[model samples]
Target: MPLPYSEKVMEHFRQPRNVGRIEDADAKSIEGSPACGDMVAVYLKVDRESLRIDDIKFESYGCASNIATGSIITELAKGKTLEEAKHITWKQASEALGGLPPIKTHCSILAVDGLRAAIENYEERHGLIREHKPTTIEVIRKRLKRVMNPMVGLDLVRTKVVKDIEIADGVVRVAIDLPADHQFAANIREEISEKIQPLWDVQKIVVEFTE
Candidate 1:
């Protein structure tokens, strides 16, 4: 890979901005694209009174372009009002990176999506915005727990132990620690896909065996 980005992108990747956690973040959001193996978690400290982003931090797992996108997004969001931050787009991130290659455009889009999701979570939790429905993750997790619990014979699987569950652009990706060659692995994958596909237009399901 001869670097799928311009010099600016490399610079940001090498010296990423806000590359850590916010100790007392008001809101945190994580998004991942299993197709591209990219994951980003964004934490924000919002000034509730002003409804502005007071501080921001990001931790990402992926390629250089993705890291650069995350770094640029955090810098762009800091000090901006929630409304302003919502308008931050992939074009702005790509421009900041001096432009990414056509193939890597989704990387920038992913970062933009993650930022928007974090802000949305913040607004919803603080009553800054009202919605008639809960988030898809909440709804799907509930359904999965209800429907799949009987099949798995477990009360609840630790969400943290899941390691990775990401939804983006109508696609959901889950990585679990099950044995690859286990007799029931295929059945489990099928069961999950069958359960969740009806709830969402799941594009992919990746099962990683930890043991």
Candidate 2:
């Protein structure tokens, strides 16, 4: 209730536009994690001849920042060329919403990631173009970077609270080091868990917290 949110963010959340899916979406992608308690799905309808995004929609699962980011991302992407839309970074998305709170930065990342993922999914599924995909660890870091602390305005990994990440046989192990008075340990663990759940190779996730 006391979270810092820009007016643009509140406006979008209060009246999120393009909240559904496109039946014949040219590109569709789901990103983020339920364990982290934020997830986003993007759908794009492109013009066949021009390769411009004619329409776009999204499905968001999370808090106000999540829904607002998803809404703003779609609005920004619509009517742009696929390449242009794919290049829309999370920072731009956040800026379009008049800048998101530090804690909500990751929400913008998830929104932009969802859109780019949809584009990549479209290209791969259609045999249009092939690109270098992120390794599992890179993917994990990207997700973790968005799991920012509300109080600190930095991600757990960047703040060194999340010390290490390990993966073996589709199971992920996370190591967390927090000050004893840290108020968000449980929530942080849940966020990290949710972020990795969508990874194809990730079957299970275990979080360990330390002093």
Candidate 3:
């Protein structure tokens, strides 16, 4: 049987609306990692006078959950003022989809983070905010260097299994590779979540595995 998915997830995944690009977009932002298996790019046409997102489009390369999330986020942000759109959180995206499987929670984060990054860029260029933004994944290793696999007793970084990590929109996602039948998969996720949750903006942590 296929993995169980909520009706909303299937709806968005099967027929993702706003599935392309916005040309000469007033603001654009992209997040996720190609090497680790997902990337999301968002483009927006903003009404400068009203500071509202007039139009939005996205291109995504990832699993079904990621695609669904990209679709839902656009639907949520479209026509909303920039301030309102900027406040769109991962929780709202997942809630709209009736919640995701724990493993798929990261996809929602990817969706919202992409939106925030684009808006942040737009704001910076418009002189709404003035702070340097790192164009790459920021400090993944330093934060979770101590997260260990209970069975192997090897920290994630030292084990070299952390293919990619992304943290934003109050969510943390770490993708790793392990044996398909690894017994402690859930344990790994729980332990890592425990260690990182307190320190980061992480309201949720997704420990995804590639077998």
Candidate 4:
């Protein structure tokens, strides 16, 4: 099938912007969608005084749409202030690509998320106020660990741990690794939500089953 991407998106995929690595990156983050088996790592150098992203690069492993998303996000973030970069939304990234298929929308969202995460890591290291919040997965993990019954045996019931967490637009997304045929998946999700309701405001929970 022909990809649902703009001419600009195809062009960027063919000739990606900022394709190489940054020699000295101020901030860097790696993200993967285990559900889709898409992984991307972004490296960035920001001008602290101006909060502007000076250089950006990416290494991606996924389909063409994933590549297009990373390329466009990097181009948009470079030379923009942290505040400005944070404002760059998935909608904008998708729009830049002409448009992505409904299912592929998450790929673009992941790119925007990866960029924001790198920036947040930069700010955290520099003692700047963090713009993103803790993801739902993080909260769930913490809660689970605290209340887990060691006597019940962690192995008896299928469990997924939070492998990666990101927050955007006041919503928390958690990447989890779980067994594909685990019969208790629904109950586990509910348990996680119930546990985290008091401590954090969770917007969404993304569960990724790894075979």
Measured by TM-score, the strongest candidate is 2
Per-residue lDDT tens digits for candidate 3, residues 11-68, read 9999998999888999887665443356689999998899999999999998888899
Candidate 3: Cα lDDT at 131: 54
Q: Can you tell me which runs of candidate 1 are displaced by over 4 Å?
A: 1-3, 33-36, 131-211
Worst 10 residues of 1 by lDDT: 147-156
TM, every model? 0.63, 0.65, 0.63, 0.63
Query: Where does candidate 2 stray beyond 4 Å?
Result: 1-3, 130-211
* Clash list (residue pairs), candidate 3: none
Cα lDDT of model 1 by residue, 1-211, tens digit: 6756788998998999899998888988765533235668899999978988999999888888889999999999999999999999889888978899876655566677778878977976787665445236666564344222222333125333244567777677666565678665565566556446533245665555567
Report the CA-based lDDT of candidate 4 relative to the real structure.
Answer: 0.66
Worst 10 residues of 4 by lDDT: 147-156
- True-structure RMSD for candidate 1: 10.7
Every model: Cα RMSD to truth? 10.7, 5.5, 10.5, 10.3
In order, the Cα lDDT scores of the candidates are 0.71, 0.79, 0.76, 0.66
Residue ranges of candidate 3 with Cα displaced over 4 Å: 1-3, 130-211
lDDT, model 4, position 211: 68
What RMSD does model 3 have?
10.5
C-alpha lDDT of candidate 1 relative to the true structure: 0.71
lDDT of 4 by residue, 1-211 (tens): 6757678778888988877678689988765433344667789888878988988999787777778999999988889998899889888888888888776755566567678778867876787864545545444455554222222323112343545556565554545455656655554455444444433346554545456
Q: What TM-score, to 2 decimals, does candidate 4 have?
A: 0.63
